[model samples]
Target chain A: MASYTERQAGSRLADYLSERAQVLSIALFFAICILFFSATTTTFLTTGNLLNVVRQAAPILIVAVAMTLVITTAGIDLSVGSLVALINALAAILMAAGLPWPVVVVLMLVAGGLIGGVQGWFISYQGIPAFIVTLAGLSILRGFALLLTEGYSIPIRDAAGFFWLGRGEVLGFPVPALLAILVAILGFIVMLHTQYGRQVVAVGSNMEAARRVGMPAKRVLASVYVVSGVASAIAGMLIAARLGSGSSNAAQGFELQVIAAVVLGGTSLMGGRASMTGTVLGTMTIAVIGNGLILMHISPFFTQIVTGTIILVAIWMNTRLFDRNWRFARRKPS
Target chain B: MMAAEAQATRGRGDAPLPPEPILRLRNIHKSFGSHEALRGVDLDIRPGECLGLIGDNAAGKSTLSKVISGTYIPDVGEIELNGRAVRFSTPSEARDLNIEMVYQDLSLCDHVDVVGNLFLGRELKRGPFLDQKRMLAQAETMLAALEIRIPRLTAKVEKLSGGQRQAIAIARAASFEPKILLMDEPTSALAVAEVEAVLGLINRVKARGVAVVLVTHRMQDLFRVCDRVAVMYEGTKVAERAIGETDLQELVDLIVGKGGH
Candidate 1:
């Protein structure tokens, strides 16, 4: 009879820590930011200021949820900012042309899906790199927005129902903030519980294996972009409703902000891993840093430089310090 | 062991058995552009037995296994499963028929946990949820049945040792109640002790009456678990022998293209 040696078992607690290390570090970083901001500025911890921060960050948070899905598939959509600008301008133009507000919303959503579908088809079916295709889309869509509006802002007037989506209140909470929270919660549930979420992770983790196991790999890959597009459209509409105007310049460089939030939330750019809770915290952290610096009497322009620097340092820490495999003390006996 | 083999043979019938294979391939041909990978190959796998498929590098062993597993569509051939001709258009089709292949690379997802990878494509879900609690309990049972003792089912596949990962992959295939299991180079990277565990696992699977096709460069492994050996050279099967009728030297000579002394 052949006898086999049993593998020595390691502690489960260490394994849990290693797996959640990135999320934990980000959470700690977020808590530290909150504490620092509260100490530096008296107004930072106030409910009014916090609500305002959530209201303003709502658009980025909405799109960041979708971008989390995109990045998890090892793909990027550089065209998101441009898509937002286009939808923003188009929503105003259509509403000004006497189109009903609800109809315009539907039209904008469909437009987003169509644009995303076209880009997705090229990337997934035509085998063009997502970076290259979306990079081209960034230029083309922005150009279309600029040409359509001729680089002008259009005012949206007398649509109180439309305005409520962005600026209205519900139980003292900003409606946009509430919507963003809902989106994040929905994203978290889908990533954790749904079959579609599993498929997305599986496709990201191992495309060949997913395909071999009979997943609709290409379709799933393309659909993530469509989700992104629809998300951008919603964010674009929200921005227009809040400002009561649409401009070709709306959401310029917004894609970078969304990507920053998602990556900061601990979603890997290398694909196959994601964290919705991390993303929610990351969005708030950035929003707080931006808002807090202004409250501290720092130059608003200077806040941009600080935000950029913080992103670089934080991501550096995330990849180098947290992700590496290193034991913290000996494994505790179970 | 000999008495067990006799019981298996007698269970089928006292009548002369023609050894109807669970999986049969005849005149299988495959080509990669200008390169001929498999040339006029014929192979058979009987129930309750191990077929050791050994050959030199590029001898079409991998390609032949792929054909049976539906990873490759043969240019011209006949594949009979359970004495009936069947053609598989995709790997999933073969999987549906309980033909499982453990690829040389293992094909387990690194980001997923052991439980998740075990039920990778076919997950157990309840009302759109993963039913993780159920899966966890079942995964414990699955590993226990295989005598594979991984301390944590929640541990990611990447966190595991190579042997443990290999064991999980085999356990996954075996749990599916596969009629035919094809493993390619499963123990090639394992340590001496790990190899023994895998060989032990093979015997356990074999005792369940599943037809197994093991393709390996490890000749010594053949004598350990294989009931029969098939030798291949340059895309053609050169020799087939029952384990009792041949020795390692003769099989090695046949693989190296030598006439026996």
Candidate 2:
């Protein structure tokens, strides 16, 4: 048999990326941003700031793992930020009301889980679109966070142990950051090593085919959201501890940032294939870009423009690469 | 064979038939509203014989195949299998009655392995978990019996050659222990060698006493495999002949509306 040459391999890669060209393009943008930041920013090259970016990206990076899984299945969750807020609000209220900090934390994680189940059910089992249901959840839960706060941040007046989750260092690195890495590692394991992870990607790739093969497609989608929900709550608690206050809007627009990170790290919005490594990189890229923008005295508006442009460029490149595969898929226009 | 021989000796009386042919068709008039697809078409698939279903473009060959597979229900028709009247609500329903349909797509999910595709939907389960080892062993036995050389049982179906894919499809169908296998253009996209491999596999399937109803556009293939030929044109089977009697040009005429004239 004749062999497939380098061109064949190249064409194959091109076709594979066509459906999700946005991921590759965003990855390229990450490289450009790293280059630009390193050339200009005095503090950008330092280990201290680089570590800071990684540390800051840690929590959002963890959540993006869930985001990647959800997105791979062509679903979206807008309630994560709100879920984080609500769980943290519960933890803050419980702790402030003189409950033991350990008890408050466990209750917060459980609150996140219960919230995940509800939102997951609505999105997966009820046949409701994830976007609408999760968006509704965002509004409803964010309101709960506000109600808990009474229009003010819930400041932990003396949260020494709880605050340590956010601020305390282990071997000179923040505890939350290390936990984030551990969770990310766990996320990778769950996605790769387990049958459930394979099933989720299979469902995301092709639901009809998945169903035909007897995979529990809906259940997998629900599980991803539940995981995201729990992770979001945990991140929220850490945020509250770090800031020493229960904030209703601590991570405003952070969902979009995490999504951007996943996309930048080469995750597909079309679902099926996810890259946890890409997501972590994406989170760090966002953190570095944001911090670099601040150091460069760039306006917030300019920062948005820069980020948006990079996303668009990444999308364009990704599409261009994928067009090569369209030859095989180009049917007679059924 | 003796029963059909006895019927021939009596006469071509076109009687109300005796003891209901293995499959009975009652003035099967199926239409697609204003445009009739089947157009009062009728067919009979006897037990343990290869039926070569041939037709021209827009001849409703695929449509009829789907009707048998329960992908489509005819507007008007009564299908009786084994002396019992039945209406198939779904393909699964038809499959339950020992009817299996194979198509060009093979309906195999490419991402999964061979055993996974073979046991898909109706996978053998030990309690709630999929019985992977049992399925693998059974799949291996079926493939080996068919004389197909696939190195990896764990290999993905997408990596399979056209012939290997066809073999897997047949293997899956036969594993279901179906009484009648409906094949729709199984050799259309096949390479030369692949086509021969499938033809041999078809023979092995027939030896198992399973009836095969194969639809084809290729006339040479009819001579190569089928024992009986049913020539369909514009939804009606206009010509029926033994495989030994029919020539390529004659078969083409029956298909394109010239041979019978």
Candidate 3:
């Protein structure tokens, strides 16, 4: 006998739209930013300027991709900026000490993973809140960089291979931009198709359930930090390569910008939801806004104010407006 | 009623003579600090039988089920599976032995799709990647076998109603071909039709020769699906009776500790 339930099947289209509502809204906002910038600024849409925006946004994109995984587990990594500065200084220092560029790169990535592993240990095994652990990491890491550099920028000379990583052009595109795109694509694939990605979402959605089902819940939680650490290390190396110098003051408040990009991309702060495509678009939107404002001759300080305002409004729209029975253009009665 | 009773008796007679239980628990005693949650309880579950576990709140009904499911380790107990003694330190170990429990929370991931949740921890993989195509195909067969209609497998669990969600949870547990399936209040949140569907699912699983433990406060369900009923009182099993030999009033009396003598 058939069941007498009142709830009937909804259309597949409605379900898809509901599931991807956040991503769609963020895409719309990003497009609006692009249109506004292209209309207002003379060189905003130029290929060269667009390339430059992506080139500069490359490091942020890499770190933001890893941060997406971290945040998807309902965890935050505030120490990412400080970790970048540390690795930047360390890579430059190691390179200046006559170590081969390749060796230095390997060492920095390992160091990043180790540092993240330690933080993850405290957060996962020790039951420390991720926010608190990363907040402390933000302080200790920056302190280490400050102490190492003694408040001075260290110049990196004679690293031709390293410089190419940040400055070289490939097929008319900046190498860093290409690399960031590759990383974004990898992030998208991993989050959607990999077992590791499913585990991450499961842990975020219901940690106890994941554990009950025999998933290595704590290890998954801890490993995400390691990923963020390695990504930050790579970003740090990229910055050092680009500038030919490493400074203790590099990437100040960089974590905020990266996080803003992620949250604005519709990755839920509460965890269990993430969008790699949205993160990519969110990063570009921020970059374009910063570039366009400067081109419009607005003071850089005012740009910060505007960026902060936009981030606030975008997130406000994300949590408040999008969550409350809002659907994009309801289907009319036939 | 006579024909139904004759059929149940014939089914019992057709089973292995003096049938060995698929699962056996002896003197299961558990304590949480000063509180004694279970006091030397014993139970034997045979294949193709639904054992209804019922009692008032804090009567150790849930605690006994948890002990069996390995969610809680009893301080002292002897457990055997098909004549082999076994000890479980974790729920996973019990799961490895083909023992599955549908927890009170249902334990479905709100963010993941129906297919993902169905294969939650035991996902199929191909070289570090989820084998999505194969998993989708297998999930189709699994749901089809259980007579579950999800409408869209890609839809997240949170979007489904309580009835559909309950069915999915049961479908997940039953699809694993478990020998012992423990359901803790599976229909406490469902409407009448949904309750009927879950009861039907229980009958189907029972027909498959799996040892079913249905824990609930809904006494009416026991007559429909349970071959026998066990009553718990204050951390101990107070009574067990064949479904045909008992009535709702007797079960209520046993649970309330007033009339069964």
Candidate 4:
């Protein structure tokens, strides 16, 4: 209670600007990417090609939104990539076994929530570090995925309509893009308008104060992980549907990319304070960068280099501006 | 002497009227390892009355409050809440029975607004949501009822002055509609005028018909707001007298045990 640290006035406004600045930067980056690629490539900005970019981004965007929420608790979920892979494997196995589409969809979502519950419970209830819980989860889920498929890939012939989730259009926009928008809106409502959402930030912002007031701290912490897990599974289903295949090797190293998008979008990984809008911008930023790289005929290897550089600079600028507003520079004794 | 003072306060109104004795403790003894924190202490609190507890450092005023509020279970003694015996293992247990304790730090959450902090541990929820608007309205009403001057309900506590923060803390506890409130040094770190502002709030608290155990090391605050002065010496209540019958020197002598006999 009393020990809960208060941010100085104007510091909140500084935070708002820094977050909004992420949106501005992302917009600028997207514009830059479009200008550069459209100038060089014959059809870099075509509607169909742009739709492909959104399709490619849809799943990663979902995963990034969840990562943003997890990181806002000052925790990370390294296993999200593996969770995605596992869901892919499960989708194939369930659908191949003649399960109904709805049944498989429900099963995938539950599996994701359950995985989150396990890791989140260990982190929040058992007092383990999220880094450790998710790190171990990453390895364990990967192992489970490999074991389920015996290290092989399974292709689904009947997942045709499901493919529309990853590529289908509604009056010309990708379904996944629309879905991402919906998720962002819902995340905003949950984080800003509900008591449970407020508690998430409260617990993330200060744990001891929450406890003294008798907040159900563990439950709040555990719920975010569940949300993250569900997001990962949804992402996995979308990815698998797009490929018409399930494989343990799918989404390898994707956790890093999702985390990069979340952080680059302006969500703090150290917990307390997240922006679903920022995450969406970050997801789109990554998508544009990836698409722009291909249009430039740059080696795919350059995609990471470009994203890492832009995000690093943006983050530094963000922190610097934040420090500036606080007049807040920590001056070491000369 | 304690018994006589306690009995005399039971008379009709305006005889220094000590209000109405709502809480009575008799010979409560507690010890931790080799140190006795409360040694056969006796005290009484009246409804709508402020009882200033004064003594030197380690005089056990805080320990006495904790024992009274059930933060710590007393090893020996009985506590009566409105003439009924009660033993509390947790603060909530006591709170549920209409007892609240306000700590010195004020224990207010800085990240949350005034209303959220007012209903901090005990929030009012509607269905699956925290009723922020209702809670804020109630907090505003509570402050208005006490006639406290807070500019806005959305103000983060960190933005408030020391006196305002204390007001919020007290408002929260009092709004819980507690029959008894134990405040632990509510104004220790405040500036002079801030202290006066707090004293005003204490008077407001008394006017609300809530019994209070006003613990402090400042005799000035004791003389100002306390209905009676209870002097604790080395964990024992050496003397407790009507404020009019007590002086600063006598209070000091009791706190230090009259030194060397």
Quick one: best TM-score, which candidate? Answer: 3
Over B123-223, each residue of candidate 1 has an lDDT whose tens digit, in order, gives 89999788888989999998887677787898778778888988888778778888898999988777786688778778878878888999998877887
Candidate 1: regions farther than 4 A off: A1-12, A323-334, B1-16, B83-85, B191-197, B259-261
lDDT of 2 by residue, B94-167 (tens): 77778887865677655557777676557676664566788889888877776666767776576677777877
Q: Give lDDT per model, in order.
A: 0.86, 0.74, 0.88, 0.78
Candidate 3, residues B51-93: lDDT per residue as tens digits?
9999999999888888888888889989999999999877788
- Candidate 4 chain A: worst-modelled 10 consecutive residues by lDDT: A321-330
Residue A311 in model 3: shift from native, Å? 3.6
- Give one digit per residue, the lDDT tens place, for model 3 in A1-334: 9887668777777767877777887788888988998899899899989889999999999999999999999999999999999999999888888999999999999999999999999999999999999999999999999999998999999889899998999888898888899999999999999989999999998998887787889999999999999999999999998999998889888898899899888887788888899899888888888888898888877767766886798668766666622344444599
Look at candidate 2 and give me any clashing residue pairs. Answer: A15-A325, A18-A322, A21-A318, A25-A314, A26-A314, A72-A271
Candidate 1 CAPRI classification by DockQ: medium
Indicate whether candidate 1 or candidate 2 has the larger lDDT: 1
- Lowest lDDT 10-residue stretch of candidate 4 chain B: B3-12
Residue lDDT tens for model 2, A1-334: 9986543322555445653344455567678888998899888878788777766777788788888888878788888878887876778778889988888888877878788888889888899998899999989998988887876777776779998998888888878889899988887876654566667766776675565344666778788888888889888888888888887767777677777777677666666557776777677778789878977888866766666765665455435544322222334566
Q: Which pairs clash in the backbone of model 3? A: none
**Ten-residue stretch with the least lDDT total in model 3 chain A:** A323-332
- Select the stronger candidate by lDDT from 2 and 4: 4
Per-residue lDDT for A1-334 in model 1, tens only?
9998867776677777777776787789889988999999999999999999999999999999999998888899999999999999999999999999999999999999999999999988898999999999999999999999999999998899999998999999999999899999999999988778888888888887777676778999999999999999999999999999999999877887888788888887778888888888888888888898899999988766766776687667656655433223344499
Off by over 4 Å in 2: A1-32, A97-129, A147-150, A157-162, A300-302, A324-334, B1-183, B208-223, B226-261
Q: How many backbone clashes does candidate 4 have?
A: 5
TM-score of chain A of each: 0.93, 0.86, 0.94, 0.87
